[model samples]
Target: MEGLRHAREELRPRRREGGPREDRHRRRTRHRQPRRPSGKRLHRLRRARGRERCGGPEVTATIAYDRPVSNFIDKLSATGHVTHKSYKKTSVTLHHNGGRLSHQGVLNVWKTRPASAHFDVDASGAVAQYVKVNEYAWAVGDTVGNQRTISIEMANETLAPAWQVSEPTWKNSARLAGWLFAKVIGERPSTGNLFYHHHWSSTACAGPHMDTLYDKVLAAAQEAYDHFKASHPVRVSNTEPFPGASFFHTGRKSPIIAAMHHRLVAKGCDLYQSHANADVWGPGDVKSYAAWQTKLGYDGAAANGTPGETSWDKLQVPNV
Candidate 1:
């Protein structure tokens, strides 16, 4: 019993000493100052991470604070056709064909017609920019209002069988329009800024498709504007090669992949396939990787296959 009591007494002091030491350590930690954010800042850090994952340039342009197109400084340049004239600038207009022209035939019409617009968005979602935003085109005809408004012509052949715009076409047009709205209005285009051709004229220009796509276009524009505002620009690699790898042969080319390659090339990535290539990812992809590696000072002779962290990092794939 005596030995046991002695041992307990000896251990109790040690336990007491340890408890106070831990408590003092925790209290000191609690009183210490909090760490500040890094030099990049929280928002910038998020944007940088997003760019790393998306493998593309971070969208940075937005229309949140932009001025309306009418407020643009260069709205008096009269250089294009003056089709139909109007006197009112109260409404934004939209238009579509009334079975008078085919999708492929629009170029000829625009060249020969007295009227032209700022944009011609095709059913395939391919947009052709004809007139500059600040220039006065003959699209709306009336001399007084022609210089004050922007016009867009949607591609359509018929309005029967319930007017419908293809998914790709609608989405692409919405994106383009949204970009234009931001550029002109100094803010993203909204439902208020969007209008149909028939809204200003007695014609059914945008056709039945406009009814279905109106809300969608507005929503898409808003989404794009938000994304643009939250994005940032960062330096990215322009290569597509991985070391010690072989290329895979996918028989079919994905349009999205081809589009990605084209965007990369436009930003100075060296790709083997020309813009006219069949959108296929193959040896051409290897060429792109090699080019990126060369840019990054990698000279160890890497080939195309599954891209590695080095290549992806260079691509600035957004981390999101």
Candidate 2:
């Protein structure tokens, strides 16, 4: 019995041994890796630019944070902070990791590699930040290019001919780029500002998927930018109460549409016959808008219920 107790104690690892405790823990933890949350998950990011459109419910960014990649003195990037004209960020460059690595797994690589980026998007549409907007991230393997552009690294679904990213990842990347454009450039995402890593590196870093789907991504980004602006409305001197397009053709509901409805009612135009609520842009709103246009002296096809620029201006839905 005494021999059995001594044998059991001998097998137990001692803390005073020359080897570190982590060595033993590493061996023990090998098969018990930490699990990432499953399914399509979303997390919101609170940035300096997110403070706008504070009243009512607004669309905040659904962003996730991985461990940061680049750290600097006083929390600055390679050449200071990101800016409209400072970083030259003339464009948003896309790249593929060329492997099916997790977003966090890519971060681990970037920690030691000579290159890094502002953001990394995984196959599941999860985004991880390796560098901040205020600092420069090494993309395209060039100093000048890195300083002049914003980088988004994507994880490929596979290697070779398919060298592609999942649909969700593509959408998330486009949305992120669009969000960045609105926040930093103060403009909508356009083809002119969307680019590929190959544009600088002369290598197919973005892979065939981006090569074939660049246009689609740009279009998606444009939609996202428009959606962001719509959700975050600002009352300007030229603010159009009907949003950008006509309420008649509008398929979505907005405060602007509600305002348009109230104005149509005030103008004594016969809106929809059902007399529904303001949250929806129904046939009534369209019919009433057309009538309002006619009252404003827009005749013929000019007042076809569609909000033309002239009628939109004349409707005079005051900016909220």
C-alpha RMSD values across all candidates: 23.1, 17.6
Each model's lDDT: 0.54, 0.67
Error of 2 at 27 (Å): 61
Model 1, global lDDT? 0.54
- Model 2: per-residue lDDT, tens digit, 118-137? 78876546566656564567
For lDDT, the strongest prediction is 2
Which segments of model 2 are wrong by more than 4 Å? 1-88, 233-320
Candidate 1 displacement at residue 16 in angstroms: 99
Candidate 2 versus the native: TM-score?
Answer: 0.47
Prediction 1 TM-score vs. true: 0.44
Candidate 1, 214-307: lDDT as tens digits? 8877787777656555655323323322211212245424343465466457658755646566366666666775676666666665533344
lDDT of 2: 0.67
